[model samples]
Target: MADQLIDSEIIQRITKKKKQLDSIRPLSKSALQKLKERFAVEWTYNSNAIEGNTLTLNETRLVIERGLTVKGKSLREHFEATNHKTAIECLEGLARIKEPLTEENVKKMHAIILRSINDTEAGIYRNVRVRILGAVFTPPDPVKISRLISELFKWLNSAKMHPVELAALAHYKLVRIHPFSDGNGRVSRLLMNLILMRCGFPPAVVLNTDRKKYYDRLKKADRGNESPFADLMAQAVERSLDLYLEALEPVKPGEEKELIPLRDAAKGMPYSPDYLSLLARQGKLGAIKISRNWVISKDDLKKYVEKKKSKS
Candidate 1:
């Protein structure tokens, strides 16, 4: 359904990077373990925070890794942190076995997300109409939810498109369905990453920092355009690829495509730092934002210039 909505450039980059990651075959064991641990923690923290969980990243680490309840936080918030970690473990299991995601998996993911928080309504769909507070669209009537979900799974079964596109659309479809009253957003993101992992891609994290952009993209999708959201997902996927490759596949000395601050990266380049930063923010350039600063690899800078040159 979303074969054409994603930016071709981003898709091509993912394709290239996926091939690169694949060529390395098995990643170093220790590095892979450490990376997975870090992602599991970051993923849990960001996903829960987006849902209003008050635990900071370090506190989330303590809760999940150290099994300590954070002070000044509610029991439900603690459960959210731990529950999300368990749900991610499930996704990792599914990814390892290469299991096809079923309708049951969807419910199970939601259930795990809502465990200890709302036991009764954990996996069950709402029986009444509901509206997202800031969303531009209303979820389908509760009666239609089952049928809508049925259709969604049918698409999941037979859809033929880029995995990244398919994953992004799946997330959008679930969020639009709003299958469960409370944990719909969390489940949608989990499902998205599950699809990616099953397809041999790293789990793409939708950072809590980008929650507003995330929702804005969804709202735009509601307005008959899926590109913005799909693009957002593609960028997330690319970021993870960079993360994994940096940790697992080091380049030969003096040839590393190391990421540098945009200002330093632009010192001798044709594009000014501000101009390149604009492009990066717009998703036209491959870059990663660290805290408040944006960084781009020299290779990505050259790639951007080559593409623009050809277009011009």
Candidate 2:
């Protein structure tokens, strides 16, 4: 089916990069620390913003890094940033040991997400029925939440799909169950990335700018069209992989052709990364593949630009 094909394709791409990453296994401690810190800020900001938290990205960083409260933000907003960072730390620890996803783990993460914001609802399933604003689908009854969640974990354990697909599907499944009174979205995303990181992949961050599209994909999954959502998660994973691989790649000496990812190759150009990728795939821009990732030399990109200008 469509889902199957997407899953296979994404798995192949991830598998290829994972192999290359393994060749550079055991990234330097400082590099790992730097990447984690950056992602913590970005992930915390985006996740909280999608949930309508008022802290700006910079404010979230200041609050988390400096422990200094924002002038106009509520106490809850500060707590959200701090708590999410704590949850991310927990996630990093779990990933180090290759921890399996479990209900208790989910609860622990949800608890951190809601700590000081809603203590009563933290880490606990709701006892009352509720409606998600603007959502077309209705969650199951509160009485059925435990059973539904148990079933989801069962599926997660037994499913043989790619990690990207499994992560996306798990996220949608949790969202549909709406097991918690609050923090379901944040918890679901945390759980999704937990699976991805455990599978030796980077965390897939759903940016705040894609909030509308994020919900729209969930809607599609709710309507029995899960492929688009899977594809979206795959792209997110690809971006994270791109980031890690680019940072970890060694700098080559001299004018000798040093191949870099399209993202790096497109720097200083008007073209977006996606556009550069498209051109590469279309053969308009000369690029080579390193384990399914597009890599182009600076000279190649310059030549391509010159060729395009000549055409114009």
Candidate 3:
């Protein structure tokens, strides 16, 4: 089952990329801090947005950093952004210590995520039976949650696997447990990145635009096909690794890293923008999604071409 959940090609690619990034360890503090700020915003905005938050990425930034309330958003949306930011901070603190993921840690994050939004339900498992809106599998009854979570930790502690695979499956297991009444997805993702960050990978931001596919992949895992969900999370970790490598690597003045949408990135290339988009979505190309548009640097495009040619 772990083999089915570990797409070898994607997992190998992620392992290779992470090793490449690790070679340049001890990055400058400024560069690291800048990436932290950027990713924190992207991470908070996209995670909340997947759950139907109305704030735009920039609006989320304003709420977290500038503390400015946006014109048209609800107070709950504002709290979601700020609370996620706080939870990220707390998560980072936990990452610094190499402790096993525990029930207390999970509850702490759930509490931060639901703070001010659902005070009564924050950090607490649901007493009432619940149903996911579009899920294929029913969540276990309220009484089963605590035992299931404990069992998950037992498996997590003893399972032998790569960190990326471990992180993604850990996410799936938590979602399967549906431990909390609210904030389950948010807490799952937070736990996902906590696993990754503890293992030295940057936080993987699952884009809001990828929400449909994201849920679809999870549902596939629910049906006992874990490969798609594993690939999805592997691609996310790969994307984050690419981001950290790009930001931490220095460039000459005349050769600054430039990110253009796939349309512009495809010019003079043999691949069409659609082809490139497919590659990007499949994690074969190093690209970033800006809002709904996928963008890549000229250098990365070149690398993709070179890598493909070599494989051929």
TM-score of model 2 relative to the true fold? 0.81
Residue pairs of candidate 1 with colliding backbone atoms = none
Off by over 4 Å in 3: 1-4, 252-259, 297-300, 303-312
lDDT of 3: 0.86
Could you tell me the lDDT of residue 154 within candidate 2?
88
Mind giving the per-residue lDDT tens digits that candidate 2 earns over 153-199? 88998888777788988988998899988899999999899898888
TM-score order, best first, reads 1, 3, 2
Per-residue lDDT of model 3, residues 71-129, tens digit only? 98899999999999999999999999976778889999999999999999999988988
> Runs in model 2 with CA error above 4 Å?
1-11, 252-312
Which has the greatest lDDT?
A: 1
Listing every candidate in turn, what is its Cα RMSD in Å to the true structure after a full C-alpha superposition? 1.6, 6.1, 2.4
**Collision count of model 1:** 0
lDDT of 2: 0.81
Give the lowest summed-lDDT range of ten residues in model 2.
282-291
